[model samples]
Target: MKFVIYKDKLVESVQNVSKAVSSRTTIPILVGIKVVATDEGVIFTGSDSDISIESSVEKHENDQINVEVIQTGKIVLHARFFSEIVKKLPDKQVEIEVTDNFHTIVRSGKAEFNLIGLDAEEFPRLPEIEEGLSFQISNDLLKTIIRQTVFAVSTAESRPILTGVNWVIEKDLLTCIATDSHRLALRKAPISINPNKSFNVVIPGKSLTELNKLLDDNQEPVEVVFMENQIVFKTKNLLLFSRLLEGNYPDTSRLIPDESKTELTLQTKEFLQAIDRASLLAREGKHNIVKLSTLTNNTVEISSTSPEIGKAVEELQLERVEGEDLKISFSAKYMLDALKSLEEQELTISFTGAMRPFILHSINDQSQIQLILPIRTY
Candidate 1:
């Protein structure tokens, strides 16, 4: 294969696909990136078994020439070397050529390097998911959904299913839920889809995290395709494939209480800041617990205490408080994360009781919900 590609564009494409490159793999060939040159453009692919990424540099884009093909072929070069060499090249453009024996040469300005590549045919084939159950979501919205929920996925591997974000698609509405037993995040958004289309899939949290980095914040739609065991996210110049986690995701709806005994409406930022300050002392505690109590003055006191560290206390005026008086203790870190995920200025936090889980939902946005189980501190 021989092609001349714009250096800046090539660097970007290489880095994007390299996110899927495997650091440890039983198959040695998987360590390299497969580059394919055709009349249309040059394609780059990288995979670590669980996730695969394919990106291309078109020969022509927006009337500008990005790549000029000298010959059409394919080769697999060591990603560690190829990526580094591409970035360090001293010219605005790079020329790559391969021989019949899989020997490759890279040139830029006055620098030229020779690399031995592997046969492209030996690389595993990417999954061909038939476009049956598919939908489109805006790039920014998709990233928002991921950001709001992925953080709550369990880091523990004991319950492998909990390590992923559960996606439930019914008609045009898509719901995403993630929980680690102690906390949960749920987001809902409308998508472009057929009314009869319904799907429930668990996508590995790690995969969504990586995919989020590559997605640009724009109104451009990202096409999502669902298959039996794999899910594909297709953008203009890229295709991302991730294997769905096997097993049924627990029914999380039952965890959210339908009613609340104590409801408090307050400024999201004010509460978030107060908790942030109290967490200084809370961090020194065993479970990083922060205690909250409703005061008779229609205000609330946020405090934390550590036997060896110290204590922190602050009281903030609430917009409104109703139902019952309450005192609850929860992880400071969890509270901060849940509050940060919200974009609203004011939110309502409802407590079923001191022991049951409490939920935080924005007054203006009912589509997002954050629930956290209270920590016991007797």
Candidate 2:
């Protein structure tokens, strides 16, 4: 393989694809990146089975030439060392050549490095996805959906299915829900597409998090194509494929209470800060629990007590309070995460009692809701 490419373009491609490279893999070749030089451009691929990222440095984009392929060939170079070398190369352009015997030479400016390259045939083939189901969404919107719910996925391996976010599409509305048993985050947006198609899928939280990093806050559209087992995300010159999680994601619809005994409307930022302060004392407690009690008609008291450490108490005057006065204790972390996901300035929290899970939502937006299971802080 031989190619001469601008150093900046090459560096960017390598850094982007490196998100998929895994060092602790059973397949030794998975630790390296597949660099394919063709007549059109240079393609870099990094994968570790679950996810793969393919980024290309095209010959010309927006009237700019980024790569010139001298010889059509393919080679796999160590991802870690090669990426670092490309970044530090003191030249405007990089020249790479691979011999038939797998010996590779990378040269830029006055620095030259020769590393053994692996046969590209050894790299695992990316899954071939046929046209099954597809839709287009704005990149900015997809990133927002990911950020709003990915944080709530369970980190424990006990319930493997809970480690992913449940995505359900019924007509034009797409809903994403994630929970770790303690806290749940949910987001919904109307997709601009045909309203006849319906689909349900579970995607790993880690995969969505990785895709979020690759997406810029740009105004371009992303094409999402999903089959029975794999999903593809395409935008510009980037293509990302991730395997779908199997098994029935527990029906969480019933878990969210339909009625509430107490409802409190408060400023989102103020409530978050109150929980933040309460958490400081609760951090030393067993469950990091914070208690919220309605002290007066519209005044809510937020307090936390640690047997060994001091206690914290703060009063938050709510914009409105209805239903019944209540007191409940839940993980401060859970409440904080749920509060941060809201885009509105004001929020309404519904409590079904001190034991049942509480629900949170924007004051005006009922499409997105968060649930937090209260902790027994006796």
lDDT by residue for model 1 (1-378), tens: 799999998899889889999879898999999999999999999998899999999999999999999999999999988999999999999999998699999999999999999999999999787968888888999999999999999999999999999999887789999999999999999877754677899999999999999999999999998877999999999999999999999999999999999999999999999999999988887899999999987899999998998889999999999999999999999999999999999999999999999999999999999999998875
Tens digit per residue, CA lDDT, model 2, 328-352: 8998988888888898999999999
- The TM-score measured for candidate 1 stands at 0.98
Best by lDDT: 1
Every model's TM-score: 0.98, 0.97
Q: Where does candidate 1 have its weakest 10-residue lDDT segment? A: 190-199
- Provide the clash count, candidate 1: 0
Model 1 per-residue lDDT at 372: 99
Q: Tell me the lDDT of model 1 at 283.
A: 86
Give me the overall lDDT of model 2. Answer: 0.90
- When summed lDDT is taken over every stretch of 10 residues in candidate 2, the lowest stretch is 190-199
